[model samples]
Target: MEKKAAEKRVQELHTLLNQYNYEYHVLDHPSVPDAEYDQLMRELTDIEAQYPDLVSPESPTQRVGGEILSAFNKVEHKIPMLSLGNAFNEADLRDFDRKVKQAVGDDVEYVCELKIDGLAISLHYENGLFIQGSTRGDGTIGEDITANLKTIRSIPLRISQPMTIEVRGEAYMPKKSFEKLNQQKEENGEEPFANPRNAAAGSLRQLDPRIAASRNLDIFLYAIGDFSETGATTHHDGLNLLEKLGFKVNKEREKCTSIEEVIQYVQKWVEKRPHLPYEIDGIVIKVNSFVQQSELGTTAKSPRWAIAYKFPAEEVVTRLRDIELSVGRTGVITPTALLDPVRVAGTKVQRASLHNEDLIREKDIKIGDHVVIKKAGDIIPEVVNVLVERRTGEEKEFLMPTHCPECESELVRLEGEVALRCINPKCPAQIREGLIHFVSRNAMNIDGLGEKVISQLFSHELIHDVADIYRLQKDQLLALERMGEKSVTNLLAAIEKSKSNSLEKLLFGLGIRHVGAKAAKTLAQQFGNMNELKKATREELTAIQDIGEKMADSIVSYFENEEAISLIQELEAAGLNMNYTGPMPVQVESISSSLAGKVVVLTGKLEQLTRNEAKEQLEALGATVTGSVSKKTDLVIAGADAGSKLTKATELGIEVWDEEKMLEEFNR
Candidate 1:
C-alpha cells in the first residue's frame, strides 16, 4: 500500500482499536467480536511495518510491549502524592467528619470510593496523548514504568479531548487473573505471590514490558493529579472529566451529603468486597468540593480533607487441628496453631501464631476446637478468640512442652519474658533459622537463596553458618538434589552481589539481639564502620538516639561474645562491606535549632507542612521524632485537634507547642 493510504488506514485502525479497548476494558462491554478487533490490529501492524515512518507512539499496536528497560528512571511528582489519614472504625470516621465539618461547615459533601488493593500509578499526558506513567515511590519521587503501564488496555493511549493532563489511579490484577498466574507459577515450580496486591505490584515492576503485558493488569483512574487544566470544581467533577477523556473510572463511587451516608456506604462494601472481581482493602472518603479540600488543608503526611476507612480484618472460624512449636534465630519457642484451611483477608490461612504459652492459656485454646482466626493488620494470621460454645467434648487440652521441639533442649522462661526459650547456643534450629535470616529480603538479600534452598544446603552440610553461604563452591551446589547449572550460577552471582551490600544489610543479617532493621540502620549510621561499632562502649551506644539501655546492653553483650567476634572476622574475610554507604546521621552541632538533641513528639496534624515533611525537617535538625508521648519526651508539637498525646505531654509537664510555635522555631 502507498504511504498516504497506509497513514489514513492506520489512523482509522487506531480509532477503532482504542474504542474497542475502552468498550471492553473500561465499560465492560464489547461492540465487536474479538476476531474483528484482532483482524484490524493485524492490518494496522502490517501497515505500520510496511510504512515504518507512519508508526507512532499512540498507535494501538504499540500497546503490545516495548523494548526492555535497563533500569527505571526516577520521576519527581510535580505535586507531592500525599497519603490519606486512616479511619479504622466508625468512631475514627466520625472524628474525621467532625474535624472536616469544623473547617468546611456541616454543608460538606464527601465522595466515597473503594480503596482498591493494588499498586498506585500516575499517568502523564500531553495534547491528549499518553506520554509517561510512574509508580508512587515515596510520595515525592517515583520510578518511570511508562512502557509497562502502556500494556494495560484500560489506560488510554489518547484521550477524547486534545488537552494535557496527569491522572492518578490504581493498577490491579483481577481475581481470576491472580488465580491463573499463581496456578502457572506453581506448575513451573515458582513461588506464588502472596496476594493480588503483591501480584499486581510485581507485574508492573518487571524490567521487561512483555512480562507486564502477559499479566492481564487493569486500571481504574480515580483522581486528576493536576485538576488546574481540566476546570474541575470538585473531586467528583475531576473523576467525571477523567471518564469523559476515555479513562476507566470506577463506577461504584457515591456522593454522601452526611457522615451517616458515608458510613452506610462503607458498611455495605464491607460485605460486598469479596464478590468484586478486583480486591479493595477499604473505602476512601474525600470532601467532594475542591475548595473545601483546600480550605481544610493537609498534615505533614496526609490530607485532612480525606480519610481512608480501613476494613476490619476479615475473620473466619476454623478447627485448631494441632499446636506446633518452632524455634527462632533468637531461640524463642513460639507456638503456632495448625488450623483447618480457611480464607481470611485475601489469603488462605492454615497456620496462626499462638505466640506463647500465656496467650494459649489466656485464650483457653484447645486442639479440635473451633477458633476465630483473623489476619492481624491484614498480613499475619492469628487466633482472635475461641468459640467456647462450639467446642466438642472430644477437644483435647493443649499444654506447653517441657523441652524445645527442635533440639530437645530444656526450655526455660527468661526473666521478664513470657515466651519459653531454648538457651542451647549450638541448637540446629537456631543455626538454621539464623542462616535463613541472613539471606532474607531485608538482610543480605541474596536472590535465589530462599528458605527451601537454604534447608537443602543445611541438610547436605555444604553450608553451616552465614559465612558458609559466601564460601559455597559451584560443584557443591550442583550436587544438591534439584540444583542445576543455571540455578547454581545464579545463586553464586547473587551471593557474590550480596557481599557488596551496605553495612546496614550485614548488621540486620547478623540477627543481633534487640536490634531490628531500623535500629541496625541507625547504629550503622552512627558508627559508620563495623570496627567502630564493635568497640563502642555501652554509654556511647546509649547516648545515641533510638538506642535504649536494654538495646545498648544487648549490643555490648553481642560484641563481647567471642563466637560472634570470630564470625564477624570470618564475614569480613569473605570480603563483605564493613562501612555504612547510606545517608550519614545529622550532627547536632551543625544545626542551630534549639530542637536539636530533644526528644520531640509530633501529634495530630499540621497544615503548613506535611507530617513526613515536618518530621524530616525536625530530624534534620537532630531532634528525635517519636510516635508516642512519654515522660522522656522533651517537647510535644501538637497540631489540629491535639489528642491524648498532647494531654499526656501537659500532664507530664513537658514543653508543648502549637503548629505556629513549632514553625517559628523551625524558621529560626
Candidate 2:
C-alpha cells in the first residue's frame, strides 16, 4: 500500500478502536469480540511499525504502556480537590442538612452517589484528548501518573467534542478483580492487599505502568473539577455530561427531593452495598444545584455542600471454637482464632489473626465464648470483641504456648518486638515454611514449587531445607501423590535452572532473620560472594547502606550457626552458583567525584535508567539518595513534571539537574 493509503487506514483504525474501547470499558458493552479487537490492533501495529511517524500518543496502541518509569513527576491541581466530611448516623446527616439549609435556604435537593472505596484521581484533557492523569495528593498537588492512568481502559482517551477539562474520579479494582489479584498474590507468596481500595491505590502508584495495567483497574467519574466550565447547573447534570463525554459514570445515583429522601437513599444502599460488583464504603450526598453548592460555601478541608455517609461495619456473632497457633518462616508464633463459620463482607469467616499475646489478654477472649467478628478492611477477618453478657461460666480461658507448637522448642519474646519467636534454626515447621519461601518468585523463583507441592515434599521427607531441593531425584518426586512423569520432569528442570541464580537469590532463600529481598541483594553486591559475606563481621555488614544494627547482627549470627555452615556447603556441593553476577555496587571514594558526599533526591520520570538503577548509580558515586528534600539535601535530580520535591529544592536554594545533566555526570 502507498504511504497515503496506510495513513488513512491508520486514522480509520484509531477511530474504530477508540469506539470499541469506549464500549468495552466505559459503557460495559463490547460490540466486537476480543479476537476481532486483537486482529485490528495487530493490523494497526504493523502499519505503525512500517511507518514510525504514524504512531501518535492518542493511538490505541499507546494504551499498552511504556518502559518502566524512574519516578512519578508531581502535578499541581489547578482547582484544589476538596475532600468531603463524613456522616456516620442520621443525626450527622441532619446536622449536615441543617448547615446546607442555613446557607442555601429551605428549598434544597441532594444527589446521592456511591462513595467508591478507591484512589481519588484527576484526569486532564486537552481539546477532547486525554493528556495527563494524577493522584489527589494533599488536594492541591498530586503525582503525575498519565502513563499508568492511560492503561485503565475505562478512562477515555478522547471525548465527543474538542474541550479542555479536568475530571475527578475514583480508580478502583472490582470485587472480583480484587479477589483474583489476591489469589495470584497468595500463590506467589506475597501479602494480599487489605481491600479493593488499597489494592487500587498500590496498583496505580506502581512505577511500572505495566504492573498497573495487569491489575485490571476501573474508574467512575463523579464530579467535574472545573464545574463552571462544564456548564452543568446540577451535580446530577454534571454526571450525565461526564457519561455523554465517554467517561464511565455510575448509574446507581439518585436525586432526592429532601433531606429525608437523602437519608432514605443512604439507608437503602447501606444494606445493598455489599451486593454491588465493586466495593463502596459509603454514599456521597451533595446539594444538587451548582448555585446551592456555591451558596453553602466550603470549609478549609471539606465542602459543606457535600458529605459522605460511611456505612457502619457489619459485625456478626460467632463461637470461638479454639485458638490455633502457626509458626512463620521467621519463627514468629502467631495465634489464630478459630471461629464457627459465619459470613462477613461477602466471605465466610473461619480464622482471624490474633497479633500477639498482649492482644489476647487485652480482649480477654475465651474459648467457647460468643465473639463479635468483622472484616477488618473488608478483606481480613478479625475478632472485634467478646460478647461478655452471653458468656457463661462454662467458657475456658485460653493460654499462650510456652514452647513451639511444631518443634516443642522454648519460645521467647525478643526485646522491642511483640512477637513470641521460636529461634531454633532446625524447627520442622520453620524448615517447611522456609522451603516454601525459598521457591517464591522474589527468592529462587523455582517454578512448579507451590506451597502444596512444597508441603507434600516436606511430608514425604524428600526435602529438608533449601539445599535438599537441588539434591532431589526424579524417582523420589514420582513417588509423591499426583506427581506425574511430566510434572516431575518440569519441576526438576525449574530446580536445575535455579541453581545458576545470582548470590542474591540464595541469600534471600536462606531465610536469615531481618534480611529482606532488598537487603539480601545489597549484601550480595557488597560481598560479591557467599564466602565473603560469611566471613564478614557485624561491623563489615553494617558498613553497607540500608543495613542497620539489627540486620547486621542477624546476618553475622545466621552464618555463625553450625547448621548454616553445613547448609551452604551442601548447596555448593549440589553445584549452585555462589558468586554475585549482577551490577556491582560502586565503591569509588574519590573526593573529586561530582556527586560525592551529596545528599541527593531523585524526582519525576527518567527516560534512561530506572529509579533503582539511578539510585544505585548515585550510590556508587558516593552520593546518599534520600527520599525527601531537606536542608541537608545538597542536590535534587528533577525530571518532567517534578512536584513538591522540586519546589522545596528551589526554596532551599539546592542545586537541581535534569535527566540529561544526570546522564552527563553518569557517563563521566
* lDDT for 412 (candidate 1): 93
Stretch of 10 with least lDDT, candidate 2: 604-613
1-668 per-residue lDDT for model 1 (tens digits): 87788878888888889999889999989999999999999999899888888989999888867688899999999987876777889999999999988887889999999999888889999998999999976577789999999999999999999888889999999988998998776543345787888899889989999999999999999999877767899999999998889999999999999999999999999999988988898999999999988898887667899999977668899899999889999999998999899978777778999998889899999899999998754666889899999966999988888998888999999899998999998999999999989998789998778777887889889888998888899989888877789978988998999989999999999999888876888999989999999999999999987899999999999999999999999999999999999888688988788988899999875534547668877888889888789878999998755669989998999999876567656545
lDDT of 2 by residue, 1-668 (tens): 78999999999999999999998987778999999999999999999999999999899999867799999998999887776777889999999889888887888989999999888999999999999999986566679999999999889888888899999999999988988998886664355676677788889889889989999999999989888977899999999999889899999999998988988898889888768998888899999999988887786657889998878778899999999999999899999999999867655578999888899899998889999998753567888899999977999988888999999999999899999999997899888999999998789999788888898889988888888899889999888887789978988999999999999998998888888777888889888999999999988878877787988999989888998899899999999999999886565565467898888999975433447768877887888787789898989998644679999999989999976567657645
Backbone-clash count (model 2)? 0
TM-score computed on alpha carbons, candidate 1:
0.80
Candidate 1: segments with Cα more than 4 A from true spot: 1-13, 30-55, 60-111, 135-145, 177-195, 198-216, 225-238, 255-263, 285-308, 473-488, 522-528, 531-570, 591-668
Top candidate on lDDT is: 1
The true-versus-predicted C-alpha distance at residue 497 of model 2, in Å, is: 17
